[model samples]
Target chain A: MVNEQGYNVALVGATGAVGHKMLETLERKKFPIKQLTLLSSSRSAGKKINFKGEEYTVQEATPESFEGIQIALFSAGGSVSKSLAHEAVARGAVVIDNTSAFRMDENVPLVVPEVNEEDIAKHNGIIANPNCSTIQMVAALKPIQAKFGMSRVIVSTYQAVSGAGNLAIDELKDQSQAFLNGEDMEANLLPVSGDKKHYPIAFNALPQIDVFQENGYTYEEMKMINETKKIMHAPGLPVAATCVRLPFFTSHAESVYVEVADENVTVKDIQSALVNADGIILEDDPSTQTYPTPLSASGKSEVFVGRVRKDLDNAKGFHLWVVSDNLLKGAAWNSVQIAESLIKNNWL
Target chain B: MVNEQGYNVALVGATGAVGHKMLETLERKKFPIKQLTLLSSSRSAGKKINFKGEEYTVQEATPESFEGIQIALFSAGGSVSKSLAHEAVARGAVVIDNTSAFRMDENVPLVVPEVNEEDIAKHNGIIANPNCSTIQMVAALKPIQAKFGMSRVIVSTYQAVSGAGNLAIDELKDQSQAFLNGEDMEANLLPVSGDKKHYPIAFNALPQIDVFQENGYTYEEMKMINETKKIMHAPGLPVAATCVRLPFFTSHAESVYVEVADENVTVKDIQSALVNADGIILEDDPSTQTYPTPLSASGKSEVFVGRVRKDLDNAKGFHLWVVSDNLLKGAAWNSVQIAESLIKNNWL
Candidate 1:
C-alpha cells in the first residue's frame, strides 16, 4: 500500500483554519500526489499557499474545480462543502468532506480511519468527517468497542473555541482583554453567533455550541449522536453528548462515560487497549499526575486520553477523559487521512 | 439570628491565597468579628495584613496560638491544618478548616451551609471546607436536591490553576509567555507541586490536581466524592468526579450529570429552583445563548448555575454547569460564612 503510485490530490477551501491544517497534514503525513490544486472561496481565490516549499496559487472553487483532481479534501464550512462536494464527486474525484453537510446522509461513510477504515471503502464518493468531539470519542472508544462491545456512551465535552472557526478564537481573546480591563465585552461570535444572545467565554461555559436541531440537540450535539452510530456501525447506539464551549483556543476535551457489555473488563484491560490503539496516546498515570488537557493537546495530531477508570459502583461502566486538537486530528488531518486511504486502496 | 453580637475570629494561614480572600470576605460581609488572630507557619509571623484598613500581625501557629480564638479559619496547607486544627479545637475554638486533612474524618462535619447547614451542629469543633470543585457543585445541586432527591452525580471540572495556589497562577503566566516565544518552560507548581514531574500548563491539562488516593481517585476526586456525601447528607448517594486543571487564572467550572430520584423534573423546573436559591444564580436559556460562566461568577459571592437541561433518553436525569471563583465561594467566603454562621447560630 505504501508503494502504490500517488494519486493527484487537491485541497478545497485551502485557506481556512482546518484548510491550512489540511495542507500541513498532507505534507507531514507524506500524502502522495502527482499534482495538486488549491481551491477556495472567491474572496481568497488569489491567495498563494506554500506546501513542501512550493508555492501554489489558489483558484476559486466552482463546479469545474475538480477537473484533474483524483482526490479532493474539503474543510470549508458546511454550505460550501454541500454546494461544491457533489460537483467534485461528479468530476471523478473521491471527496473527503470535513463538514457536517453529508455526514448523516446515509450514502456517505463517516470515517475516523482507525475506527472504520473499511467503512471508507463503502463511501459513495463523499466521505464525512465526524464532529471534533465525536472524532476523539470514537478514536478512543473504537478499541473498547472492538474488544468489549460498548452499549451506551454519555459524553460531556469541554470544547475549545477553535472548533467554531478562527473568529471564535479572536472573540475569546478580545473578550478576555475586555474583562480584565473592566470594559463591557462584546460577545458577538460565541455560543452560536447567529443566536440572539452572546455570553462571555473568557471565564464562562456555553452549553450550546451550534444551532439546535429539530430533535432538541444542538447541531454540534446531533453530529456526535449521529456520526458515532455511523462510524461504529452501530445504528442503534445510545449516544448522548452535552457539548460546552470553554475558554480554550484549541483542542476539544471530553469526559466520556461508557457502559460496556463486558462486565469483567478491568481498568488494566481498558488501559492496555487504549494504549495499543492507533492515533491514541494514553497519558493516564495517576501517580505522576499524567493526563490530558486542551492546552497540551493543542496542535498535536493524536487523541490524548487519560483519567480512564472504572465507575465507582457500576461494575460494567467506565469513564475516560479524552482530548485532541480540533484543527489537526479532528478535521484537517482526518480529512487528509481519508484522501491518503483512497489513494492507498486504489479507489482514487 | 443575623442580628448578632460579633464572635472572636482567628484566620490561620493568614498570608496565603485563601487567607487573603478570607480577609476580604470578612470585611465585605462585615462578619461579626469581635477579635481577629492571624496565624501562619512561623515564616509568615510578624507579617502585617490589613483588614478594613486595620493592621493585624501574623502569628506563629502553635497550640498556644488558639488561647482565646473562638472561630478559627484555617487555609494553610493540609499539613499545617492537620497539626494545628486539633490544637485549636482543644482550646475551645471551632475550626473551619479549608484543607483535605479532616474532610473524611467521620466526626468532622464537611459543611457547605447552603446545602447542609444543619450538619454544622454535629461538628466536633472541626469543620471541613469541601474541594473547590465540590463546593460549586453542592451549591448548585443543593436547590435541586431540595426540590428533587439526587440519586447519582458525575462531574468533570474545568478548574482554575489558582485553585492549586497563587504560585501556579504565576507559573501559568510565565509558561504561557515562554510557550508563545517558542521557549522551553519550567514548572515549579501545578498538577501537584510535590510530584516528581511538572508538565507545562501553558496549553495543557493535568488530570491530577492533588495526590493520588488509595481508591485510585486523586485526592481532588476523593474530596469531591466524599465531600458531596457529607455536604448533601446523602450517605447512599453515588458520586464520581474527574478534576481537570485548566489555564484559567480564576473560577472553577464543572459539567455535572445527575440522575434525580424524582421523575420528569423538567429543565424549567430545575431552572426555577436555582433562580431563587440563596448563593445561586440561574442563567440557562438556550435560545438566547445565555449560560453561567466563570468570568461572570468571579468577584461575586453567588455560584452561577446554567446549562440546566433534561437528559434525552433518561427522563429522571439532568445536566447542569456550575461556576464560581474558587477563592471566593470555594474557600475564603465560605470560611467567612462559617464565621458568620458561628455568630448567627450562637455556636461560638
Candidate 2:
C-alpha cells in the first residue's frame, strides 16, 4: 500500500533505454511521488520525457540535482553514475544504481529483492542493481538455492542487444537490414561499444559480452560469477559463466547447469521449489512443449525457468533453462522493486 | 594410412541432405570402393546425384537392393530404415544407419570415431551416427572423460534448422523474406513442421526441437541423452539435455556443464587435455574474443570448443562451449569416418 506522504523521486539518465523503462515501471506500479525529477547528460537534458501524460523536462544531473530528492534511480552509464551518484546519495536520497559502478563494492548491497531483499536495509543510501544476465539467473536460482543449497553453477548466456544500450538496439536494426539486403553487416556498437574491433552480430553469435579481463573472463562473465555469489549470499559458492551476445533484441536466456549439495535432490524437487519461488515463473511442462523463450519473456519482470531435469546417474546434478526480460527484471523493475523494499523495511 | 582393397559400398537415401554430404565426404576422403550403389525411396528413384564430377542414378531401395552390397550407408527416414535395414543385413551386407530407428535398439552401436570407434566391431550389421548435437559433444568430451572420469553432464543446445532437413531450410528463407517485407512471419516449418503451430526464427529462438517425448524432453533431447551414453559407452553416466533450435543454417552449439570425478581439476588442465584430444579444436582465447561460433564452425568437421572454465568454488566442475557443423561432424563426416575406421580395422 502506498502512503499519502509521498516522497520526491528523481530518475537519473531519464532519456536512456533502461531509464525510459524505469519511468514506465514507476508509473505502472503507481509509485508515490510528491515530485519527479528527470536528469540526463547535458546533450539530452532539455528534452521533455512524458510519464503518465505528465511532461517533465530533463535536467542536467549536477551535484545540486538531488537537493530535494528522496529517491533516485540511476541507469546512466557507469561513468555518469560514478560522477554524480555520490552527490545524489549525500543529499539524503536513496540511490538505486543500474550500472556496474558499485555492484562489486563490498559495502554496497547488490540486490535482486526476490533473492536479497533483506540486504536492502544495510545499504548506506545506495543499492547496486546487478548485471542484467546475473539478475535473472539469481532470481531463478534463489529458491532452489534455499531448498537444496547450490554447490556449483555453470551458465552460458544468450543475451540481447538492449543490454548494451540504445545504440545497440539501433545497431541491431541497422545490421539486420544490411544482412537481409545481402550487404555487409556494419557493426559499431557491440559486443562492446567502447572496445576496439567489433564483429557483426546480425547473423552471428559473439562469445564476448564485455571487454576481456586480465584473467580471461569478460567483465560480463565476472559480473555473473561475482554477482551470483553476492545476491545469493553464498560467497564461497561455485559459479562460472560464459556470456555471449546473440542477435536477440531484448530478453536474455541462460542455459544453467547446477549441482546441489543434497544427494537426494531430484528434478521434481527443483521444479516444485521453482513453482513456489517468489518472482519466478516455472514453465517446466515439456509434454505440451512449454518452456521459456526470450521473445515470450520480453517486457516481463518475472524470471522464467523450464527444462529442469536430473542427470541419468548423478542424483544431485540438475539443469535448468532460465530467461527474463533484461529491460525489466534485469534493470527497471528490479530497481523499482528495491525502492519498494526499502520503503517497506523502513530504510527509505 | 591408405588401403586399396576396400569393400563394395552402397548409399541408401542418396538424394537427401545427409546422403549428399555423405557422397561428398566419401569422394573427399577417397574411400577405396570396388563398387558404388546409390539407393533412394520410390519417389527419388531414377534421380541422379553428382559427386566429384561423377553422376550416379539413384535406384529404388528394396530388399533386393542389398545384393552384393558389402556395406550400405542408410540415411532414409526411420520407417524406411526399420523396414529395409534388416533385409539388407540378412543379405550379408553390413549397414551404417543414420536414423533413430536402431540407435537405441540395444544391439546397435552409436559411434563417433573420436569417442567410440572401438565399438564398431560389436556392431550387428549396423552402426549409428548420433544426433547432430550429441556427436560433436561426445567428440570433445571423450578425451576429457578418459582422463578425468566424468560423473555428470548437463547440456543445453543451440541447434540449427538444417537438422530438420531441406524443406525447413526453404521455409526459413521464405519466411525471412516475408518478414523483411513487413509481411506476416507466416510460419510453417520450425519448432516442428509436423506440429500444428509454427513460429518465426529469423530474429528469434525456439526452445523446442523435434517432437515431444512422453517425459517432456523433445525427441532431439532424448537423442542427445541416449546417444551420449551410446557413444561415450557410459550408459550409467548422468546426462541431462535441453535441445533448442536457433535460426542458423548450419552448425550446432552446446553449453556443456560437466562434473569430473577428480575434485581438484583446474580449467587449465581441461584446456590442455582438449588441445591434445582427437577431433577437437580448442578455440578458447578469450583475450582476443576467440571462441568457436556457429558461423565460424559451419562447414567444418572438428568439434570446436571455447569459453572453457572451472566453476568458481567447485574444483571438480567445468563448463565448455562446444560448436560444430551439424551437417559435417554430426552426420556426413562421422558416417564416412566410420566407414574408413571399418576398412582400417578390417571390421567390414
* TM-score for predicted model 2 compared with the true structure: 0.92
lDDT of 2 by residue, A1-348 (tens): 455788899998998889989988998998887899999999998999898898899999999999989899998889999999899989999999999999989899999998988899899888999999999999888888898887878787888888988999888778777766778888787889878768777766777888998777789999999998888888888788888788768899988878798988877889889889888999877666678888788878899998887755566777788999999999999999999887777888
Give one digit per residue, the lDDT tens place, for model 2 in B1-348.
Answer: 344676688899888878888888888888888888999999999997886677888999999989998889999888999999999999989888888888887898888888888999998898887877889989888888999999888787888788888887777667657656778776777898788667777767887898887765678888888888877878888788878777667788888878899987888889999999988999998766788888789878799999887766567878888999988899999988998888788887
Q: Alpha carbon lDDT of residue A44, candidate 1? A: 90
Give a tens-digit lDDT track for model 1, residues B1-348: 553567678888888888888888888887777888888998889998998878888889889989888888999988998898989999999999999898889998888888887777777799888888888899998888888888889888888888888788789777766655568988877778888877777556667778887666788888888888878888889898888787778888888889888786888788888887998888766665566676667888889887776777688888787889999999998877776676667665
For model 2 the local lDDT of residue B34 reads: 80
Across A1-348, the per-residue lDDT of candidate 1 in tens digits comes to: 553567788888898888888888888888777789999889999998999999999999998878877888887778999899989889988888888888889888888989999888888889888878889899999999999998888888888888888789788777766655568888887887787777777646667788876554688877888788888999888887888787778898888999899889999999999989999999888766677778778889999888888988788889898999999999888888777777678655
Candidate closest to the true structure, highest DockQ: 2
| TM-score against native, each model | 0.94, 0.92
lDDT of 2: 0.85
Give DockQ per model, in order: 0.43, 0.47
For all predictions, the C-alpha RMSD in Å is: 2.5, 2.8
Q: Look at candidate 2 and give me any clashing residue pairs.
A: A313-B238
